[model samples]
Target: MKTELEKMLAGELYDASDDTLFAMRLKARQLFTAYNQLGFEGTAARHTLLKQLLGQCPDTIDIQGPFYCDYGCHISAGENLFINFNCIILDCAMVTIGSNVAIATGVQILTAHHPVLAAERIKGPELASPVTIGDNVWIGAGAIICPGVTIGDNTTIGAGSVVTRSIPANVVAAGNPCRVIRQL
Candidate 1:
C-alpha cells in the first residue's frame, strides 16, 4: 500500500511525509515568501499560493502572515476558514479542517507521528496519521494539536492547550493534554 507520505507527495492525501517531502515543503515556503512579500492586499495572492500548496482549499479562506507548513500538500481547509498570524501546520498525513473554522494566532497542527520502536526511530523515516477537525470549531492561540486527533463540531480549544487526544463535539477543552473542561 502507498504510504500517507507518498500520497501527500502525489497530492492524493492531505497529509504525508517522505524523503522528498522536505523539498516540496521548501518549494511551498519559497512560494509563500514570494507571494507574502507582495504586501497586504496580497491576501488574495497569499491565498492563491496556499491554494496551490495545499491538497485542497475552499474559496472563503484567509490566512495572515508568517504561516508555516512542513508539507502544504497534506493540508486542506473548508469554507470560511480564518487563520490568524503565525500559524504552522506539519501535515505529514492529511490535516483536514472543516468549514467556518477560526484559528487564533500561533496555532500549530501536526499530523506526523513517530514509531516507538528504537530501530525504526533511528532510521528517521516519517510516519503520519490524519487529523480531522469538524465544522465551526474555534482553536485558541498557541495551541498544539497532535496527530490523528478528531475534534468534533462547535468545539473550542483554549489557548496554550496541547491536544493529545480526540475531543468530542460541543465542548470547551483546555490545558496541557487538552481535556474537556465543560460543554459549550
Candidate 2:
C-alpha cells in the first residue's frame, strides 16, 4: 500500500490527517520559525536553514527570510533565484522553479487544492498538483500561482495577479485570471 506522502506526491487524493504527514508539517513549521526569526545580516545562516528545508538549493541563490512552505523536501529551486520576503509555497506536491527567477514579496505558489463539492471535501481525501516555473521569470508581489500551473521562461507576472492557467514563454501577464497582456 502507498503511504499518504506517496499518494500526495503522485497527485492522488489522500488523507492529510495521517500522523506521518502531520509530523512532517510540524517539522517544517519549526524550521520556518527558525528561518524567519533570523536577522537581516544572517545570510549564511539563512542559507544553511534553507538547505535543510528545501529538496535542493544551489550555491547561488538568495531567499529573503520569512518564507513558508509545506513539505520543503518537495521544493527544488535552481541557481540565481531571488525570493523576497513573505513568500509562501504550498508544496504538497512538487514545486519546480528554475534559475534566475525573481519571486517578490507575498507571492504564493500553491500546489494544494481542495475539492469543489462539499460532499467530497468533507471526506478524508484531499488532492494536490505540481507547479512548475521556468527560468528568467519574475513573479510580482502578492501574486498567486494556482495548482498545476506551468509558467514558461522569460515571463513577467504583474503584481496581485492570480494565475489559474499555464502561461507560455516570453510574455507579460496580469489580472485576476492572468491573461497575456503582450509578448516580450
Candidate 3:
C-alpha cells in the first residue's frame, strides 16, 4: 500500500489531511515563517533555512522571502535561481525548476488540483501533478503555472498570465490561458 506522501508524489489522489502529510506541511510552515522574518542582511541564516526546507537546491539561490510552499521537500531547484518575494509553490507533487530561472514576485506554481466532478470533489481526496520549469526561463509577476504544465527553456511568460498547458521553448507567452505571443 502506498503512503499518502507516496500517492501525492505519484500524481495520484490522496488525503491532504493525513497525519503524516499534515506534519510535513507544519514543519515547512515553521521553516518558512522563520525564513520570512529574517532581513536581507541575514543571508546566511536564510540560506540555512532554505537548505533545510527545500528537497534539492543548489548552494546559491536568491529567493526573496515570504515564500510559501505545501511540502517544501517536494521542490527541487537548480543554480542561479532567483524567485522574488511572495512566491507560493503548492507542491503537493514535485516541482522541478532548472538553472538560471527568474521568477517574479507573486508567482504561484501550483501542482494541486481536485476532481472535476462535484461528487468526486466532495469526497475530500485531492489530486496533484508535477510542474517543470526549464532552464533560463522567466516567469513574470503574478503568473500562475497550473498543474502538469511544463515551461520550456528560454521562454518568457508575461505578467499575470495563467498557463494551462505546456509552453514550448524560445517563445513569449501571455494572457489568460496563456498562448504563444511570438517566437524568440
Candidate 4:
C-alpha cells in the first residue's frame, strides 16, 4: 500500500490528517516561523533554515520571509531564486522552479485541490498536482499559479493574475485565468 506521502507526491487522493504528513508540516512550520522572525542581517541563519526546509536549496537563493508553505520539502528551487515577502506555496505535490526566477510578494503557487463533487469533498480526501516554473521567469505580485500548471521559460506573469492553465515560454501573461498577452 502506498503511504500518504507517496500518494500525495503521485497526484493521488490522500488523507491530509495522516500522522506522518502532519509531522512533516509541523517541522516545516517551525523552521519557517524562525526564518520569518530573523532580522535583515540574519542572512546566514535564513540560508540555514531554508536549506533545511526545501527539497532543493541552491546557494544563490534569496527568499524574503514571512514565507509560508505546506510540506516545504516538496519545493525544489534552482539558482538565483528570489521570492519576495508574504508568498505562500501549498506544495502538496512537487513544485519545481528553475533558475533565475523572481516571485513577487503575495504570490501563491498552489498544488493542492479538492474534489469538485460535494459528496467526494465531504469525504475529506484531497488531490494534488505539481506546478513547474521554468527558468528566467518573473511572477508579478499576488499572482496565483494553480495546480498542474507549467509556466515556460522566459515568461512574465503580470500582477494579480490567476493562472489556471499552462503558459508557453517567452510570453507575457496576465489577468484572471491568465492568458498570453504577448510574446517576449
Worst 10 residues of 3 by lDDT: 56-65
Error of 1 at 118 (Å): 3.1
Clashes of each: 7, 0, 0, 0
For model 1, residues 1-184, the per-residue Cα lDDT tens digits are 8854565434343333354655777787887677557677766777788788778887798888778886677777899999999898887678999999999999989876666788867665556678899999999999999988999999999999999999999999999989999997
Question: Per-residue lDDT for 57-111 in model 3, tens only?
Answer: 7887899989999989999999999999999999999999999999999999999
State which candidate has the highest lDDT: 4
Cα distance off (Å), candidate 2, residue 48: 1.0
Error of 2 at 41 (Å): 1.5
Ranking by lDDT: 4, 3, 2, 1
User: Candidate 1, overall lDDT?
Assistant: 0.82
Candidate 1: give the clashing pairs: 5-16, 5-17, 14-74, 14-94, 15-93, 15-94, 16-92
lDDT of 4 by residue, 94-169 (tens): 9999999999999999999999999999999999999999999999999999999999999999999999999999
lDDT of each: 0.82, 0.94, 0.96, 0.98
lDDT of 2: 0.94
- lDDT, candidate 2, 1-184, per-residue tens: 9999999999999899999999999989999899999997988888888898899998788888788998898999999999999999999999999999999999999999888899999886998999999999999999999999999999999999999999999999999999999999
TM-score of each: 0.87, 0.97, 0.99, 0.99
